[model samples]
Structures are given as C-alpha cells and as structure tokens.
Target chain A: AQSVTQPDIHITVSEGASLELRCNYSYGATPYLFWYVQSPGQGLQLLLKYFSGDTLVQGIKGFEAEFKRSQSSFNLRKPSVHWSDAAEYFCAVGALSNTGKLIFGQGTTLQVKP
Target chain B: VTQSSRYLVKRTGEKVFLECVQDMDHENMFWYRQDPGMGLKLIYYSVGAGITDKGEVPNGYNVSRSTTEDFPLRLELAAPSQTSVYFCASSSDRNTEAFFGQGTRLTVV
Candidate 1:
C-alpha cells in the first residue's frame, strides 16, 4: 500500500511572496510523485511530476519540486506566487506494481492575501 | 479538453450516475474517490494505466467504460459509505498526466 501526506491544511501568503508546500509519501520501492492543483469549483490540474533522474523537477507556472529520497519528501516551491495561485494543491504517489493508480494527499489549500 | 458539470448531490439508497465525455479521444479514463480530510483514491481506472482495472473498494457499482471518449460510473445502490466527491479523469498517454473533471459531490444517508 502507498500513501501521501500533506502536513498543511491551509496556508496563507501575500502576493509576490515565496511559497513552499510540503509533501511526504510512504511506499515500498521507488515512488512516482506528482503535484496537482485544483481551483474552486474546478477539476484537478497537473502541476508537475517526478519519476527518475533529476532530484529537482520543474513544472508549469514557474513551480518546481525537489525530491529528497532521504527525507521521503517531495516539496513544491515557487519563488513568487500570484493571487491566482490560490487553490487546493494535492500530492500524489503512483503505484509501481499495477494499474498505475495514484494515491493522493489530503490536499493543502493556498490562500493569497493582498 | 475535459469538462465535468456539478451534479445535484444525491442521497443514500438512490441511484447515482455521472458521465464524462472527452473530446481528445483519450485512451485512459479513471474514477477517483475523495473525502474531506482525505485525498483522492484510485477507485476504477481504465485504458492507458495498463489495462482496465478497478481498485479495492465497496462493491454494488457498475461501470461500462469501453469507449475511450465516453466513460460513466453508475451506482446501482448507493450507500452512506459512497458519500464522497467523485472525479473522472482522462489522459492521452500512460506516461503523461491526466486531466480531471470538476467533480461531483454525492451524499448518501
């Protein structure tokens, strides 16, 4: 069984401020990690994913994540966030054995403060 | 492109249905289970995730998702446990990420 955990339930940041979202996963072997965003009354959108090779993976909208094998963490970071960045963010881990099922985190809601 | 409209929240012991249509002719269609304080759980996934397969969950549900463009999940007998937000997703390739539906919130008594 694989699982993902996002410690923060909600985070508020001012516009133009840097942002960091924490994510941790529990898996037996090497895990496939992904970050997704969901706007209010909207579907989930892919932010980024990490499979192999580089520890740091870049994603759309100037967002990036660093995969730390030792920490069992893949944290999403952005140098600056806009008001439009406010949304529900989810962290997911893919199954390697079969089905390619994605186990997601509890989700962190970002609130941009003006 | 993928778009899902908000469905009227249904109660328990009622029949629940949701349809997702994809214009891109995606090969993969998936249903994810989500609850408050819990993230999305893979319930039924078909197509590019290496064949059609459903995950470990409560039964009494039927899905005929043979077509790549249209996929629907039907709950013949909904229960209290089935009260959760359901999302449908589609992806063109197995390696790429999927686009998700807006999600339908179902409340079962």
Candidate 2:
C-alpha cells in the first residue's frame, strides 16, 4: 500500500546552517504529500503540503518542500537553521479515500548546536 | 485551554478511557492519534457520530463516537506496550488540513 519513509532518524546541524530532510513515498497514484513538525511534548504542526500544483511548496515557519514525482519524494528544506527549528519532522502521504487518512514517515529528529 | 495533555495509568486489567472533543464542528475525528513511534499510525477514525472505522493499527483498541463533539477511545486491558503519546485531530473535510490537540503522554507502567 501507500507508505512514507524518512531515511534520516536523527540529524544535527549548527545554527545558521542549511538543512535538508529526505523523504520518499510509495503510492499507486498521484499522492498528496505533507510535512509536519512536532516540538517536544507538543502536537504536530503542518509545515507544508504538495497536492497537485508546483513542485516547490512553501509552508509556515520558513519551511519549504519540493515534490519530485519521478523520484516519489517530497523533501523538506531550510536555508538557515535556528535553535527553534530543532524538532521532529514527519513526511506523510494522504490516502486516496475521502477519509483524509495519512501514512506518515518514521520521522527525523533535528538537533541544532550553537 | 488544552485537553488531555497528559495521562499516567497503572497496567491493570481494567480499561482505560481517552476522550476527544472538537469545537470546530469537524466532519472527521481521529484517535491514536498522531506520531509517537515509527510514525503516526491511525488507530481509528470517525466520519461522524456513531460512525467509526478501523485504521492501520486497530487491534487491542476500541472507539465510539457518541456525538459530533466527542470521540473517545477505550483500551480494554492496559498494557505496557501501550505506553505512547496519543493525539487527537479533526478536519473539516478530506482535502483540508487537520487541527491537532496538544497530545496526551500516556505512560502505562
């Protein structure tokens, strides 16, 4: 079935450094992709989504993601990482059914070092 | 202002109840309800009151949607393996984004 995979389990980056989190998905048809961020002990916050339009999508908190159809990937990126940017990131694919069910990736925990 | 932010329960044969309510009049409600492990697995979801469906991992868990405002999850027998943060979310429709709760850190020991 449909699934999402985030290759990196944990990543550490210095403050002000660029960041990229990889994500791959498996689906039968055109997939609806989304990126979510969760702070410690907090609920998930939507970062961005790619439904059908442009490959590059911008989201809240200065986050952006690119959906590559050929690679079946939706990768998140940030030009400059901040201390507050350290959080667990998840990539998800929406099921075709109208339930809005989402298959999520294992998640990548990003830690920022000063 | 947040609901079900944290829960700590002893591992007893007795049942554990998890409740969720949505004030936005959302058409969909989900329990499990977001990520804590490998990824966020949908345990159960309801389209409306009295209408619920199983999701990716539904075993050992039961749910009931009594009203549009309330969707509660029931664990028949609490187990240590059930120790994970639980989240509740709602959405207006399948195409729209879901709104999530602060999450409940359920620790079963």
Candidate 3:
C-alpha cells in the first residue's frame, strides 16, 4: 500500500531560526509528492509539489523541499522561520492515475516562538 | 475568493449538512475530514455531474450531486468522532492543482 509519513508530530522553533520538517513516502513508481499547510480553522494551501526534474523545489512563503529518491524522502525546509509560519504541515503522495486521491501523512504542527 | 466557514457546532443524533459549489467548471469534487494529530482523510468524491463514490470512511456520511455546480455532503447521525473539519475541493483532470474551500469545522457533541 502507498502511504506518506511525517515522523514529527510537533516541532517548536524560535522566530528566524532555520526549520526542517521530515517526510517519507512508500510507493511503487516515481510518485507525485506535495506539501500543504493549514492554518487554524482554515483550508489547506498548497506549498509545493515535486513531479520530475531537479531534486530541490521552491515553494511559497520562503519554503523549499528536497526530494531524495534514494531515501524515499521529501523534507520541507525554510532558511528562517516567521511567526506566521506556525501551522499544521502535511505531506501527501498522489496516486499514479488521475484518481484525484492523495495519501497524506499524519501532520506535523510547528510552533514558532518569539 | 473562496470563503470556507469557521465552524459548525451540532449535537449528536442530529443531521448535519455541508454544501460545496464551485464556480470553476471542475470535473472532480472531493470531501475530506481532518482531526488533530492526523492527516486529512478522504470521505467521498464525485467525478462528474452524477458520479459519486464513497471513500475510506463512509459509514456515517452521505453525499449527492444536485448538478455539475453543486455537491453536498450530509451526515444523517452525528457522533463525537464526526466533530472535525471538513474540506471541499474541486479540480479538472487537466489541472493537477486542486482548489480548496475554506473548510467547515463541524462539532458534534
């Protein structure tokens, strides 16, 4: 079965600190990977997606993710965190076909400190 | 802008209604449930105007397509576990990016 995993349940970082959120996935073929963020009582916003090409992909709000095929990981990183960056982050893997269904990992909640 | 409501509070055994309409001529519509400490799980989905499919969990929820422009999810009997945020998303098969609604937080006591 295809699945996505976010090892961290909660992470705390000081504002302006570098942040990294870990994610791993299980799939048979080259998979479509995505990162999404959801604020309190809001819907999810797409951060970035990796389909093919360069291992590193840049997303909105100064967020970037590195796709390591050998490690089966696509970890999200930010050079410096902002207070508003505090939100629930999710990692997802899209199905091979156009099922429009994504397998999501248990989310990681980031708490930014001032 | 797409506006998703903040929350919906309802009591157990009461019917809860959720409506989603997309201005975009999207062919795919989906409903997902989210809870603290967990990722979003797909509840139900509709491919086109009249095609609907139940997702991983569909025991307590029912969905319908009134038209190509309207898709609503209905919960006949609510439970404590049903108290979570529900998201509606729409997208065409050509566009991989799915557009999401603001989401409704349904609380069943």
Candidate 4:
C-alpha cells in the first residue's frame, strides 16, 4: 500500500532562519509527490508537486521541494522562514492508478519564533 | 466569501448532510477532503456526475454527485468521532492541481 510519513510532528525555528521539513513515501512505482500547507482553521493550499522531471521543484510562497528517488523522499525547503510562514505542512503521495486519490502524512506543525 | 465555509452542529444519531459545490467546472470532486486530526483521508470521490467511488474510509457515510456542480456527503449516524473539519476539492483532470474550499467544521454531540 502507498503511504506517506512526516517524521517531525512539530518544529520551531527563528524568523529568517532556513527551514527543512522531512517527508518519506512508500510506493511501488514512480511516485507523484505533493506538499500542502494549511493555516489555522483554513483549507490546505498546494505548495509544490513533483510528478516527473527535475528533482528540484519550486512552488508558491517561496517554497521548494526536492524529490529523491533513491531515498523515496520529497523534502520541502525554504531558505528564509518568516512569521507568516508558520503553518501545518503535509506531504502526500498521489496514487498513480487513481489520479486524485492521495495518502497524506500525519503533518508537521511549524512554529516561527522571533 | 470563502468557499465551503460553514460551522455545523448535529446531535448524535441524527442524519447529517454536508454539501459542497464548485464553480470551476472540474471533472473530479472529493469529500473528507483534507487533513484534520490523523491526516486527510478520502471518504469518497467522483470522477463525474453519477460516477463516484468509495475511498479509504467510507463506512457509515454515503455520497452522491447530483450534478457537475454539486457533491454532497451524508452521515447516516452522526457520532462524536465524526467531529472534524471537512474539506471539498475539485480538479480539472488527472494531471492538474486541485482547488480546495475553505472547509466546513462539523461538530457532532
């Protein structure tokens, strides 16, 4: 079965500091990976996705993710974190058979400290 | 106005309805839409009007796609465990990114 795992449950970083959130996925074939961010009491917003192509993918809000086939990981990164950047992040694996069907990771809550 | 934004309260054992509508002319619609609690689990999804599929967790829930614009989820017996935020999303096709609604927070007591 295809699944996603976010190892960090909560992470705190100082404003302007670099950030990296780890994500690992389990799938039998080439995977379609995605990263989503959710503000408090709001719906999720797509940050980035990796379908096929370059390993490094850029997304909205200055976010970027790298898909490493060898490790089965699609980790999200941002050079500088802002106060407004704090949000819950989720990594997901899209089922190849079912286009939109996704298996999501538990989630990592990011807190920005000044 | 935020899409699919609402707060609902229902008593246990009561039948509950959660409605979602999209104006984007999307071909796919999903329910139990996003992450809350354990993570976002798909309860049901529809490829098109009158074409729906059960997802990861579908027991005690029923869904219908009445039209291209509407897809509603029905909880046969509302339970406290059912208290969670529900999201709705739609996408143009298999390869395209999906658009999400603000979400509906449902509390069953």
- Candidate 1: residue pairs that collide: B12-B109
lDDT of 1 by residue, B1-109 (tens): 4435475566677887777787777787888878877878777778742356776563766667666677777898788888777888887654667788888877776
Instruction: Write down the TM-score of every candidate.
Output: 0.88, 0.95, 0.93, 0.95
lDDT of each: 0.82, 0.85, 0.88, 0.86
Q: Residue by residue across B1-109, what tens digits does model 3's lDDT show?
A: 1434567899999998888889998888888888777798889988898899988777899999768778888999999989988888887862376778998888889
Comparing 1 and 2 on lDDT, the stronger one: 2
Best by DockQ: 2
**Using lDDT as the measure, what is the rank order of every candidate, best first?**
3, 4, 2, 1
| Native contacts recovered, each model | 0.66, 0.66, 0.49, 0.45
In the range B1-109, model 4's lDDT, one tens digit per residue, is: 1345488899999998887888888889988644344778888999999999999888888999879999888999998888888888888776667777888888989
User: Which candidate, 2 or 3, has the higher lDDT?
Assistant: 3
Local accuracy of candidate 2 as per-residue lDDT tens digits, A1-114: 788889999999999999999999999998888899999878888998888888999999888999998998899999999999999999988887988778889999999999
Q: Which stretches of candidate 1 lie over 4 Å from their true place?
A: B1-4, B48-51
Give the 10-residue window scoring lowest on summed lDDT in candidate 2 chain B.
B1-10
How good is model 1 by TM-score?
0.88
Residue pairs clashing in model 2 are none
Over A14-53, each residue of candidate 1 has an lDDT whose tens digit, in order, gives 9999999999999998888999999887788899999899
Q: How well does candidate 4 score on lDDT at residue B37?
A: 46
- Per-candidate RMSD, Å: 2.4, 1.5, 1.7, 1.6
Candidate 4 CAPRI-style tier: medium
